[model samples]
Target: MTALSELNDDVVRSMSIGAVFSDFDGKINCLDFHRTADLLVTSSDDDSVRFYDIATARLVKTTYHKKHGADRICFTHHPSSIICSSKHNPDSNGEFLRYLSMYDNRCLRYFKGHKERVVSLCMSPVNDGFMSGSLDHTVRMWDLRVNACQGIMHLQGRPTVAYDQQGLVFAASMEGGVIKLFDSRSYDKGPFDTFLVGGDTAEICDIKFSNDGKSMLLTTTNNTVYLLDAYHGEKKCGFSMDTSPTATIEATFTPDGQYVLSGSGDGNLHAWNISDEPNKVGSWDSYIGVVSCLRWAPRRVMFAAAAASVLTFWIPNDAKSEPGAPNPEG
Candidate 1:
């Protein structure tokens, strides 16, 4: 099916959990999709990583890291290799990230730098460069070719980092609602522009750029998500979710960048239209618990949400096929 078929408000509203995977024993901490493949990867508190073939709608493989444990995982440029944080395991020394080859179940390399647990991790859309934001109040940059950190930025409060669609720039959101934009090549020189969100004054849960790189998305612990102009840093709008004191509900922009969706404290998946004025467009049924993680496929007509031990995929019931389909950033 063409991705545009699923982007319609009615199609989005018609979406419901079409598939459910309950193999996880503990909460799923992170999940990512292969950049140009129909594969999905997820890591959970159960100390396991699972891979799925989204094109076939089947679980492909499962690997365990019982010793070091797995959390905050993402695929490197290569689908067989993944980089993951190992802070949940007591045996692991603090702040060591693992580059693992899941095909053979081997540790490829260890990336060490952060003094505290990493709360956020993302790969650059255009290259091998990746970033990790830590509770240590620092954001570190790395490349797949290097085991050592390439660069790091210190900031106050909890830090979340994200790169624009082109990977030409990266943005960092911190406590006190401060957001700084840095040129990818010379971030060390300091942010070229900074925007103060004014009043959030809380730990940031996530930050993201729209597929077109025209807007920025920020979610905070105070249960608010803000949409902003990427070029001028003007607030386009803000959406309030349920009061979620315990979970970090992530908000993701649709692949077309016309709408945004998030998990809420009430256990439902909520969506809003942010292209002009912000309005609640739809709120799907409860996802069993607070949906701590939600992602839209970067090129597909699908999305997924995880809460507690269940991972559910959403799709329109009558989605029709075309010659090609674009996906979302799951």
Candidate 2:
């Protein structure tokens, strides 16, 4: 059931089971599914953000990004709020970025900081704080409840933000090749520790905490993925794909944490068995371009992947594939 279409040179469209609609026009850069609501929110390149009714497959509302399209967007666990940012505009020195915006219908606020483009964004699970990483070489936390913008903690280079189950923060940098950990409660108290993964150079695009938060999966710009112990910082396993460097945009664990799924620049979603073996799994290649964002839906027993334009819903298969799931080509 892959919706087949050519959105653009930079975008692709593919189909999957639970997805009602897919936009292949590069209108959306990043998207997230609300945990309890039948809604989907997307941040796009056209300086606009949109909300969609998943059940009806229709756009609900659009919020202006104010500049160019946003590079990323995320919904707060609060269920009523959202946070988003755009790519660093070199002319702005990465400061005063129109990046870092939040919305809740009752109120909307834009965070002013980060001299460079804010490439990474996330909300803290244990608290009301939000974190962002930028090309300006810092990670900052914001308290939405208090409306305060906390200043930077030096990660020494551009970093990506990931949080573990215990609420500790991980900041993986572009220059240091290490992952920095900070206790969500330890800010302003003292120094934080960094976890270095040797032998990798390209910028870390994204890092995710495993289901139990015992381990984390790291993705680099060079299309490399590694599983590392969350506590000891020891390496668990490393894997790479034959596709272009783009496919490794994000790596996430299944809702049950029994499987791992990653989106690639080569326009495919690779699902691997976390418990069955290590590398044995399946892949879906219906999108036209890079699969930029991915999220798992446990209640539906499926996951979703978004490229520049389209979105696809994926379901696991047994010997008899499900009705909507196309057989794996790899």
Candidate 3:
């Protein structure tokens, strides 16, 4: 197997959109790839959840939540299940965090605790547990086998929660540009480490840990992305470009941690090389609306980007070439 550090820049530059799926009636809110399968799931404002087979580039199933509608979604350890936040029955009030079985479109569990909309949801990398950050200023943890919230933490700001690749540490980004790191095994003791970023005016939209669990990435509504040392909470780098004041650009690190990617309101996707000086390396125009969601496939040399109602999958032009091989067209 080729080491990720050995990935050729030419291969990275050769990436191009290979497939486009346009079926959503509304904007795509989130996209997640199954860790162990060539499958992906997306939630949209259209109140639906759709699954696709990445290998076949085919839409496999579509499920609807007509009442409140689905928003953020993450696939669980089980291939046939997913957890999403959606509205509850109108009469009951508030929203519900649902664990749904894709095999039969049944909601196997409902973790109903968030008093407001859940803006962030992430499944634990090593177990059937998951965590969610909500506008209600709380982070709630849940176990798939149970219907109740296992733990909860109140935050001073709207929270964005994520578990590291090893599931040993979980980070929570909250108001006032504060990020608190907690030991997953004993989070109730309070965060063991904390770091601050941005300013009072900045709103953190997302937080993600690198695949190797060595670093973390934070995306802000201020159109800036920060790379931080996961072990010590030290800032590594910050990425940004000229963007609209209203743009909520979401950024992500490549699966190999060699590059960082973000979607801009200017209808383009941007990538930066992170190994050396962080510099803009590539940009692709989607020609659609604001590219809101961007995700690299966990186990392949491909990624998927969504903007408005369009979804596009990108792959290296010579993806099948052997490692260390020169590009024929170059």
TM-scores vs. true structure, each candidate:
0.93, 0.78, 0.91
Per-residue lDDT for 29-64 in model 1, tens only? 888888778888999999999998776467788998
Which runs of model 1 end up more than 4 angstroms from their true locations?
A: 90-95, 320-330
> How would you order the candidates by TM-score, starting with the best?
1, 3, 2
lDDT of each residue in 224-258, candidate 2, tens digit only: 77887777888877777545643446677765555
Q: Could you say which candidate leads in lDDT?
A: 1
**Candidate 1, run of 10 with poorest lDDT:** 320-329
The C-alpha local distance difference test score for the whole of candidate 3 amounts to: 0.81
Per-candidate Cα RMSD to the true structure, in Å, reads 3.2, 7.1, 3.9
lDDT of 3 by residue, 1-330 (tens): 233455566666777776788878987889999989989999998898999887656778999999768888999988879998884452354447888999999988778788888989999988888999998899998899997789999998889999999999999988888999999999999999998885435778899888888888898876778888888877888866456654466777777887888887677777888776677787877666577788988877777888778888777776435553222222
Q: lDDT for each of the candidates?
A: 0.82, 0.62, 0.81
Q: Which stretches of candidate 3 lie over 4 Å from their true place?
A: 1-6, 87-95, 198-200, 244-247, 319-330
